[model samples]
Structures are given as C-alpha cells and as structure tokens.
Target: MRTVHPTVRLAVVELRETSGPAGDSVGASTSTRGVKSTQPSRPTQRPTATQSPMDQFMPKSMSVPKQGQIDSALAKMIAIDFQTFSIVEDRGFRNYSNSLNSMYTIPSRKTLSKSLIPQLYESTQASVRERVQKATAVCLTTDCWTSRVTTSYMSVTCHFIEDFSMSSCLLDCFEFSDIHTSENLAEELLRVAREWQVDGKVVCCVSDNAANITKAMNIFKWTHYPCLAHKINLIVRDALKGMKPTVDKVKAAVEYFHRSTVGAEKLKFTQRQMGKPELRHKQDCTTRWISTFYMWKWFLESKDAIISTLAIVNAPVDALTQEEWGVEERGVQSPGTF
Candidate 1:
C-alpha cells in the first residue's frame, strides 16, 4: 500500500465530517467549498432558571395593568352604556380575563346606580340641551302609560329636520304623580317644553285622541295633530268588538297551553306529528288592535294543530266550541270581510 500525502489525507477527513450522517455529496461540497455555507448553524441554548411554584402554572406571557389604567377603564365601562351588575358578574366574563382572574375587581350594582349613573346623566343632559338649541323648529309628541306596578309615566319625544332629514330623540320620561287630568298634563307638558327651551320653537304637537291629551294640547295652544295610526286603530277596535266572544275563546285556548309547561310540550308534539312548523300563539294587546288581527290569523293558520294539541293534553274545555270554530273559519276565509 502507498502512503497517502498529508494534504490529501486532510482533505478526505474534512469531506467525511461535512457529509453529515445522511452522507449527501451536494451538502458536503457546499459546506467544504471556499464559498460561505448556506445551512443554518445549530442554536446554542443556555439552561433556563428553575421556575417557581406560581410561575409553573402561570401563562408564559401575562399582562399586568397599572392601577391608574384599571380605574379609568372601570369608570368608562360604567358610564359608556347601561349595563347590569349581573353582566359583569357573569361566569364567562370572569373567566375571560387571564391576567387577573380572581384578582380582577368590578363595582357592584349599588355603586353604579348611586354614583356612576347620576354622573353620566348630568353629562348627557348637557349634551342634549346643546343639540336642541341648534334646531330651528321642533315637533313634540307625548304619551302617558301605567306600568305593571301601576306607576304612571309620561314620555316626551322631540322631532326636527336636520340636514334635510327628519331626526327624532326622546327628551325625557318621568313619573307622573297625582290624577292624570288635562290640566295636570298640560302643566307638565309646558314645564318640559320650557325646561328644554323648545316651547318657542314648537311648531306642532301630536298625540293620541285621548280626551285628556287633546285637552292638554288646547291648553298649551300648540298646533295639535291627532295621531293617524291611533285613529285607524280605534276604527279596527270598534269593528272587532262584535267578534269578542270568538276572540276570547281562542285567546283562552292559547293562554292555557302557554301558561302550562305540560300543555306547551303536548302542543309541540302535536305540531311535529302533523308535520307543521311549531308556532306560538300571539296575544292581543289592549292598546294595539293590530295584535288582535295577528292573534286571529295565527289561530286560524294553526287551528288543526291547536285542536289536536288540546285533545292530546285532554283539555276538551279549552278547545273551541262549534260556533266559535265556525266564526274563526269565516274570519280566516275573508280576513277583509270583517
């Protein structure tokens, strides 16, 4: 055997080391050549310090808010819009914060209602006054209604043409005390108008044709327009008064199923068996005559399913009587005939 030259032996050893375990000649040549190597160098990692008990469970990156930032954000949340305490206390809301979790603090409902709401109301009231001052003419609408607790409330709305488009805003809603007579209503309406400085700008006032409301408008001496919708509603209501017996029977049937869970479930089952889409009966409102039309229409549409459901629930009394059924059939056939 001939002895290898020292230079040749050195080149061979260099090539073997560059070839890597896969022994690719191209990689070996690219690395061994005088050209700079294109391959990346292995990263040198330093040993990390041992984590503490808390760090082990904590997120890799955590955001810690400064005390001032947190307080400012909390105040904005309360003042920006009306939100309930239960919303902030919701399980999903609490779990959404990764940084503070149990440490995150939110104000209670009492704190918001007594402090934040009043502060916000003052600021909003000033803003509304500013907008109202810029309007050339404003139309006023007022309505009074009693709540579930029998507390009376009067709502006032302002409408004006802004940028050639009609825009409206609710000026205020306040509890009305004492008897709701025309004199009392007129006093309140004029007070609200004067407070907003819109009394002089008021060109028209619209309201339902309640005797008290019309009388109030006369006392205020404002141009009054009876609400056209209310007139139409009155006509419809008067016409339907004769059909009350039939309407009442249908309403009772619907109320029976709606108020009882077992009856509702039986209705759903009956609807499925009849291959009908599940529909809940609509209830008529004392003020809204259109609701009565919807109630009757829905009853007629789902008459078969409703009768079947009554049978399934063993509620014979709740089912419509023969005369009542005939009335519904005729009403459904000629909805306009009524």
Candidate 2:
C-alpha cells in the first residue's frame, strides 16, 4: 500500500470539509492552492448614522495665536501713550476697529495685560541689555519722588557712548515702598546694577544733593556728582530769601489778577490798547527757582498794561513802586547769569 504525505492529507481534509463531502473537482482545488496574496487583508468598517462623510479630511480645531506683529504694535502704543489696559474694552474703539477690518480681532485687555505687554517689555529689555553689555563704561542718573496719589517711586537712567555716538535708555522705574534710607537706596542700586550685569562698569552716578542720596552714593562706593541745576537752584533760593517781601507783593498782584475775571479781562483789554499781545502772568513755583525768574520777567514785560489795568479796576493790592520794578528787573537778570 502507498502511504499518503501529512501535508497532502491535511489539504484534502480541509477541501472535503469546505465542500461538505461532495467536494469540487481536483482542477478547482489545484487553482485555489499554492498561491499567497501580496496585500494584507484589513477588516472593513461602516460609517455610523451620526458620522459625516467629510470628517476624515478636516482638522479638529484652530491653533491659538502667539505674539503677532499687530499685538506687539498695540502693546507699544498703550505703553508709549500711558493708556490704561481697559481702553481696549471701549465700545467706540472696538467699533472703529471692526469697521476697518471685520476679519481681524482685537485681543482682550486681560491678554494684553497678562501676555503681550509683558512679552514686549521682555524683548525690549533684552535688546537694551545687549547694547549695554557692549558698552565699556556707563553713567547713571537716579531720582525719587512721590506721585500725585502720594505713592513713592524711583527711576534710573543709563547713558553711554558707542561708536562715538551717545546712547541712553531707562533702566528702571519702580514703586519704592521702603523708607529711603542710605542702606535701602544702596541695596536697590546694587540690585539693579547686578541685574543688568553693569555693576562693575558703572563709572559715576548723578543725583540731586539730598542727604539720603549723597549718603547712598558713599555707601554704594561709586563716584558721585551733584546736578549743577539743582546746585544753582539752591543758591538762587538762598539769595532770594532777603527779597521775600518784594517777591510776595508781586505774587499777590498775580493772584489778584488771576482770581478776578473782571481784572483779567481788563488786563487783556489794556494789552490790546497798548499794541501788545495778550500774555498772561505766570505764577512762580516754590520748587522750581527758574519759575521765579519767569514770574519777574512777565511782571516787567506787562508792567505798563498791568499799571493801566490796576488803575481802572481799583485794584486792592499795593502797586509796585519804581524801586520795586528796578529790583524785579535785577532779579530777572540774576537767574540768567547762572
């Protein structure tokens, strides 16, 4: 008896089972066997009723914008103009922008405050730092003052020469709630200097002759120069103390004209009649000594018109005598000499 091979026996059994004992002819089994498919078979799937035909071709969602040019420009404008962030929320502004370009949208104020503005500031600061690092030496000017709301603040500015051209930039302007003692001021200066990596390159500092500032410079161990304008102001203020009576009388005269509408109108009419332009008298500020010179100068320039107006209005204040006029003229020349 001839023995059957195991592979042939297994193939025959599979063919018999598929055909259910009444198997197809030998030629049909030979055509289907010994051939392998080149492509792999994958299970087919049907779309559900809720699925869209175009779903496979479309993206899930749009990407959010990072810092763009328009956003940067808007941030720069707000900073340069000192506008509040809420200005972006104004209906009129929004309407104007929408009319110009409906497709473009303005960023919300929260985004500007939290992201774009800070990003712009950081980029600008980096640019400034790069320039400052290239400099060999730098000078700084610092000042401290209280705002109208009584908040104290300090500002520092840096100046340097690069390629024979003068360049300057503001280093810092921050709220300073600490008491302005010499130690506190010195610590702040060192902190800023180190932050910009310019601590070793600072050659000198210029500030007013306030006791705390002068002491701070000593503690900071940098060369210090007092502002010349401030020095002159101190000198002028000291010299004028002897002439307080005369200055007070002139100030009172300016106040009278300013307070009375009739007196002011009369002064303008007098100026017109005298072939002079209408120049209002300037009041002097106690802090700025130069304003004192301007006050005296205007008083002398409009002296004739003032005399005529005062005579007509029956002014309550004492009129400046000829000696006082000479004294005022000399006072105007005094500040000019410095």
Candidate 3:
C-alpha cells in the first residue's frame, strides 16, 4: 500500500509500541496482529545525497568531472574583442599597421605554412554571383599602370546603381592584368559586367575620351560618356600656351610668395583688408569670391590696405610681352601673371 524509508520505518515502530490499542498510532502491523504480514521487496536504487544544491537535478549515477582547458568562459572574452585573435595562431586574422614616412619600417611577415581552410566554396560562389545580380546596372572604368614590384596592373572600376527609387550609385575598384590589350580589356570588361549582374542593364560605360575605350564600347550596345571635366582641363592647358610667359611668371610669383614668410604676412594683411566691403570705398575693382577664389577666399576686410601697402612686392609685370607697352589693362596694373 504505502512505501516508507528505513529510518522512517524505525521511527514508526517506536511510535506504534508506545501507542494504546485504540488507534493512538497509525500502523497496520500492530493493529492487524491476527493476520500474518510479509515484508515488501526493496527497490535497487543508487544512494542519493540527503543535502546538496544539485541533489534534485543530477542522477545518482552521473559522475562530476574536472573542467577542461577550453571551457565556455574563456571563449567569451575573445569573442567580445576580436583583436585578441593572434595572426600567428589564426592566419585569417592578420595584423596590418598604417605606416607613414619618407623611409618606413618594414612590417613583420608571417609565413603561412599551414592553415585550416574553411568550406566556403559554395558560399564564395554564391557571394560572387550575388554581387553582380544585386547591382542591377554597372558602369566600367579602367586605368592601366605598372607597379613598383614590376607587376603590370590594369584596374577596373565598376559603378553600381541603387537609390530610394531603387537607384543606387556605387563605384568600386578591382585590379586585373595590364598585359591584356584593349581587346583584352574589352573581354574582361564584359566578364566583370556579367559578374556585376549587368547583363542587360548597363546603360553606359564612362571613361577618359580615349580612342581604345571608345573602340571597345563601339562593340557594346550601351552608350559611353567621356569625362567632360577631364577634356575641359585638357582644353584649358592648351589655351594657356598663348599666354605661357604670363602664366609661368604668375605661377613662379605665387610659389615665391607662398614660400616667403614676409610675403605670407603681406597676403594675410591684404586678405584682412579685403574681407569687408566698406574698407574698399568702391565696388568696381574691390576683391570678392571670384576675384580671389583660391588664395584670398574668406579674406578679412582689412586686407585691402595690406595689398596697397605691399604695392612694391616682387610681381614681374613685363613678363607677358617684350614690347614697350604700358603695364596696365585700361587703367589697372596687371599683377605678374606669367
């Protein structure tokens, strides 16, 4: 009927013997003395601790082993700060320091003799393909050069499209082989375009107005836009030829002034004078943003007096021409423009 522990059964015996026959204690053995009773079979159970924190949770037979070298706790610290991963031990996490100087110190190179390569073939292939497809449209730009290590490099530039209107503009760089001719650049461009998932969405290819690039684009269906800003710069360079001497003198004087501390102070003084409109007294030839775009941008109002004060500063006025001409355009003297 009911189960009892050994110590509990012994306590029950003591209580039963002291009790009167009129049910003072609750025990079947003393109350039913007329019937012969048989002892119940004991269950085979491992001994359990009477008092322990883990006593209720752990099985009696389960062993408690020593903690190993790589338990869970130490791994958490490394995960929190990835810089703890040593490149020597894990080659994938290499150290790269930014060095800047005329003569820089060489970084220590680790010889990767062995490494546990991850199974990323499927992942890598998917990533490579997705980069192309998600990009929608792409523009290709390429530049060729030879590196210091004598390696021929041709860098391909790709600009992607995406935005709020699903219109996004993003350009990235990838280097290729320079040995590949314009023909080769053509093939690689096509391949990379496909990789960018730009099979049909490539609206344009933008680059310098080079004949080879144009020729390559001629084969493609997409339009090619030349860098108009680069072309304009080229045009300006050619336009400067007629006034080369004036330009040269102007350049030399600017360099000289930039190098001279006295000249810089004079320029600063002029900038301060020109900064305010009231100091000039007239608007006709007073300096503004356009008059001093680069050098005296945001010049102070007091700079007008400084420029006049430094009137005899070494500005070679006669460099533009050898003729005995007046050193003035209408009435204003020309600064050393060459």
Candidate 4:
C-alpha cells in the first residue's frame, strides 16, 4: 500500500542484507534499497507549435531576417545571372552561406531561372532603353556565325556616347533563317536598328571583310569599317605560308611530345639539367594568329632543351631536324611580330 514517485518507478533498485535487531543477531534480513532523492525531477522542455526547430539551435540575440530582405538578396543574385545549377550546386557558394548562418535557405535553380531572372531582366532592359534613347549617335557592329548545330545567328552590338563617355551594349542576337545573301543581311540589320529605335541615330556599321557583309553595308548605305584585327590576321597568315614546312616540323615535334608521356618527361628532365624552367610546347590555333606566334615563341625559348630531350628519348625521324630547328628559330624572331 506504498506510493512511489513516477521517476522512481523508472530507476533500478538493489537488494542487500541487514542484521537482525536485538534478539537474533545471527539471522539476517534482506531489503530493497535505492539512493535517496532530495528534489522532484522536471520534464525536459520542447519547442512549441509557434517555435521552429532551427530557433532552438540559434543564439537568442540573432533573429531571422524579414522576408523582404531575403527577396532583395535573391534579386541581386539573379541580376548576376550565373549558371542556374551553379547557384544551387557549387560547393564554394554553399560554403559561403554556411559561414553566414545555418538558418538561411538558398533558392533552387528552377526558382532562380524561371521567376527571378525574367523579373530582373525586364527591370534592367527598361533602364538601358531610357539611357540609350538620350544618346546623340550610336554606332553598330554586326556579325554572323553558325553554331555547331548549323543554326545561323546574327549579333548586333551598339556603341554610343552617353553623358560624354563612350558606352557599348549588345542590342540583340537573333536567329537568321533567311538566305545569307547581302540583301537579306541588310534587311535584318535595319530591322534590329528600328526595333531599338536607333535607326536614324546609327551613323556607322563595322564588320569583318566578308564579301557578303561588305556588300550588305553598301546596300544599306551606312558607312562601314572593316575590322582591323581581321586585316592583321590576314597579313600574318599570308606571310607565314612560305614557312609551312618548318612550321609543320615543329608542330609534329610538339604533338609527339604531348602524346608520349615518356617524351614529355624527358623534356622536363633536360630542362632541369640545363637550369631552365620546364616549358610545354603550344599548338597553333587555326583561327588565332597570336596562338601561332606563341607556339613558335615557346619552341624558340625551349629549342636547346627540346633537342637534348629528343636525343634522350630517341625520337623518330619525323622529329625536327637540325636545319628545321634553325629555320623555326629565325622565322619566329623576325620583325613581323604578331
């Protein structure tokens, strides 16, 4: 008929022997015992319906930001317009947020691309149009290129003086499905100019020396400037045609070194033996004349090391001969610099 505390029922007890009182000292009795308790236990407190699970772990001095602040931050990220998946999946971005606060949540790729980007783009487009409309004169440059999928696209860029300073912006880039004739290209350019409301303000158009593009500008009656970079590339390409045999020998040697790990290691060892920095041979790019210049420059700088490396590796006869090496060295060091 004894009552026990709720906590006591959950605890363990031990049985021990106790000596009998005065009459029979030899007889012993057994009794159940537990540690004496002084105060009643209290139940652990838990979060209420109103409190979030994260609130328990956060410092009391810190509070969650208002919804508006979060939206503003999301809008800024959208303005940057990085790849959608990178915002959600990049390790560096996730680590950066963790350093700020664990309670902050990042928007998913779908929300960023579908909702936020369109909103930001519209706002920015309005502002750009306002500024562009006030400009005195705008120059335009157009280019057409075909993608890997064989889809042709035309890009039009605008340059103008805004508040006494030069400003450049991309007006539009659209697919061109019509025939790539001069007349068709001229029409497309005029259409873009009208859409941007800069048709009358446009004084000049710049383009590469493609015959079709040149003819297009003539038809449009707009002053045209041929791209200077393209002209320089043409000059270099024509000048280097005479040195093709020597250039080809150098290119073959570079390809041999790159494709053969053993040959590359030999080159590195030769560089170290001669107190020179380890250098990799560069392959010339078909489109970029500067890449060709660099390829020759690197070969010129590393010629002795390359020759010794080739000897050590016992490279095939296709490797650059002594006369071919001299030819390349002289050709790259000529006055016609890229």
| Among all candidates shown, the one with the greatest lDDT | 2
Across 1-338, the per-residue lDDT of candidate 3 in tens digits comes to 12543223121211113333674432434227675456432333334334434543443331222122221222333433543324335433322211222122222222111111122234444655566477656666665555678676555565665453433323334566455556776776787666556658777877766677677777765688887765764564564467555434434444545566776566656656667333321111111212322322212233344335346575433332333122223112323331
- Name the runs in model 4 displaced over 4 angstroms: 1-81, 90-92, 101-103, 146-152, 175-179, 255-266, 308-317
Candidate 2 — which pairs collide?
none
Over the stretch 1-338, how does candidate 2's per-residue lDDT look in tens digits? Answer: 12654222121111121222344422232225677544433333333334324643443332345336667888999999999999889999889877865545788999999998999899999999999999999999999999899999998889999889999989999999999998999889888889888899999999999999899999868999999988988998888888888899899989998899999999999999999999978998876898888888888899999988988889998888788888888767775552
Rank the models by lDDT, top first.
2, 4, 1, 3
lDDT of 4 by residue, 124-194 (tens): 88888888788879999999988889999999999999777889888889999888899999999999889
- Model with the higher TM-score, candidate 2 or 4: 4
lDDT of 1 by residue, 231-251 (tens): 988988898889887777877
Which 10-residue window in model 2 sums to the lowest lDDT? Answer: 8-17
- How much is the lDDT of residue 53 in candidate 1? 54
Which runs of model 2 end up more than 4 angstroms from their true locations? 1-67, 95-102, 255-276, 304-318, 330-338
